[model samples]
Target chain A: MKVFVTVGSMLPFDRLVCAMDAWAKEHSEAEVFAQVGETSLCPANMEYSAMISPSEYRDHFAACDVVVSHVGMGTIITASEFCKPLVMLPRRAELKELTNNHQFETAKWLEGRPGIRIIYSDGELAEAISKSIGSDGGSIVETGTRGKLINTLRQFISN
Target chain B: MKKILAVASAGGHWTEMMLLKEIFDGHDVAFVCTMEMYRSEVAPNRFYAIPGVSRLYKRSIAVSVAKLLFILVREKPDVVITTGSAPGLLAIFFSKMLGARTVWIDSIASIEQLSLSGRMAKKFADLWITQWPHLADPVDGPTYQGSVL
Candidate 1:
């Protein structure tokens, strides 16, 4: 299995990266790559970099079977675009991992969505990863709403 | 062709703006984002990178605002649009001061409610939008047209 982990460009999510790295250490069957941002924590078991170009990010996202990351909307949208199962761990405000608790709110709203799993604790990371290995990925269907939005904006701009 | 300033902070806001790339077709478009590296994504199109700030980063907000004002003056776009966070909100505010039309698309990630920035953008945005239809209200608005996601 190929796993791509991202913590976003703005902040470091050491908790998520550490959990995934621990899991990677025990699982020789999986190839794990991470975009860890500018963090002090280095993953001993996974290939990681501070950041990757947007195109390179897309390339890794397209090639991955599963994605593991924080409750970032970019990651969520990209995972859906590529039909990849996603395992999300939200950053806590109290932990000072993020500016606020918006991620927790996103996680709450995303609960029970198909092919997406949200785990509050890193303890469940292994189980989530194990369960997602062979599962069929999920995709966001392009809806007519998108076209209408484009048209609305296009018309508004032209006028 | 109208000059359009497309602004978004990095991460989801930038992602959402990219997904709406079609809106920029045939228009004179310039992009503003938080991450300098994203210049490649909108290559050949004019791109500007500004310092990203949030409410928590109170100190940096002034610096970001100054940069945004400079861009707005230089571009003098006909319209400014963003899938927002703090920086986008600032762009919308400054764009309006410059007599430019502004659109604010609340991030899809704000499924529970409009983001803090999105909520504040309501007053400044000439056309406010929300991805979730349920969040739209005729009285206050954040009209639901469709989602970029």
Candidate 2:
């Protein structure tokens, strides 16, 4: 199985990257690739880069069976669009991983959503990954909502 | 075709704006985002990158405001829209001052309440929207049209 891990473009999420790398080391059967994003820690067992082009990011998202990420909306939305199961860990404000605790709020709000799993600590990453494999991912995108939003914008722009 | 200036900060905000790409079809759409590399994603259309600012980064706010004002005066777009954070809020404020119609779609990540920037946007935007239906109200806007995600 192929797994893709991303820490997002703005901040370095060493906690998530290091945990996944440790998991990768133990799970030789799984192929792992990561977009590490300027983190000081390097993953010895997984393929990694500091950043990738937007198209490359999409290509990785499309190719992977599961996505590992911080609880960022971009990752969540993209994973939903691709129907890929997502395993997320929220960045803690006290840890200085992000400017605020909004990620925690997002995680709480997304608690029971299908095809997505939220793990609070790095220690839980491995089990979450295991649970996510071979599962059909959930979608947050609603076609009716998209249509209504588009129609409203079209009318407002034209008016 | 109307000239539309679409602004978003990087990451989730940019993703939301791109998902609404279909709305800009056949119109003249220009994009302003935080990351320089994002220019590749919306090529052939005019694109601008500015230093991103947040409540934590109060120092950069002046630079962003000046840059957004410059873009607004130069583009003179007929309409401006953002799926936002701070930069988009600034864009909406400047665009309104420039006599362009403005729309602000709050980021879906702001699930509990409107984002600080989204709240500020309600004052300046011609149309303010929230992705979550529960956040929408008839008296207090950030009306829910629907979500991009």
Candidate 3:
């Protein structure tokens, strides 16, 4: 149905945006929206924006059926909060895409989490998107815990 | 009710702070972060944005520290917590000066060791938690608390 792809706020992730565009073209029925960051490649198949304001950012994620993002913590946490299925593409330091390889480390650490699919390359993104949409974001996330983490927070604050 | 101040510089730092959302839900929570085109997780009244420290350049941290100085005075929170970057460090620094308890939960992305900000937080944070088991050093104030990821 609806897909939102975010490459995060700082770097260019044209590889992801381009792959997602190809995926959307194949799907035909899926609606794709992307926050492309400072990338040069423009997508002709999907709705694209360089960046969005705070309210619009949340609204887009909330409305999307699935969130495809770089392995940045911001994107992952936001996707988890919306209970949206996620396709995380880790940026590689060897490729000069990021300052370091921490995103690769994050993907390694997050391997078994529910409803999350980690793609090492653009080739894997289409399948993850297909799987996410097919399951209606049910593969990685099950029950939404709106207040689950807050309880721990309140306890920490009182002490 | 106790008031809390949450500060994270954005990206992984902000994400880590938000993963602890339970702590801020009902409290008089206020947040400070790097400038972004995104909205706050909480209400607008509870959020502040300052320039993020450029990891490549040390100058940005000083600017944000100056901005955070005033907010710390105004909020006068009972406690301050962050999943850190330089902004979080500055917030904690000021919070400590203002007599607020401070907590630092290092980012999970630091698989090998504590981040630069996490290391800086050691002298200030009342409690320091690490997501990775290997990074925990109880004597140094960083303890294993499982993961927020």
In order, the Cα lDDT scores of the candidates are 0.89, 0.90, 0.77
Per model, kept true contacts as a fraction are: 0.76, 0.84, 0.44
Of the candidates numbered 1 and 3, which has the greater DockQ value?
1
DockQ of 1: 0.69
- Whose TM-score is greatest here? 1
Q: How well is each residue in A1-159 modelled by candidate 3, as lDDT tens digits?
A: 889888877678888888888888887798889999877887989999987765677899888888899988777667767778888999887777777787888788778787788989898887787777745443342223324434555677888
Instruction: Specify the highest-lDDT model's number.
Output: 2
For candidate 1, give fnat to 2 decimals: 0.76
Question: Which candidate model has the greater DockQ, 1 or 2?
Answer: 2
TM-score of each: 0.95, 0.93, 0.80
Segments in model 3 whose C-alpha atoms lie over 4 Å from true places: A22-29, A53-55, A81-83, A112-114, A139-159, B1-3, B22-27, B36-40, B57-59, B146-149
**Backbone clash numbers for all candidates listed:** 0, 0, 9
User: What is the lDDT for B9 in model 2?
Assistant: 89
Worst 10 residues of 3 chain B by lDDT: B36-45
Q: What is the Å distance of residue B21 in model 3 from its true position?
A: 3.9
lDDT per residue (tens digit) for residues A1-159 in model 2? 999999887778998888888999999988999999877887899999998878889999999989999999999888888899999999998988887788999999778889989999999888889899999887854546888999999999999
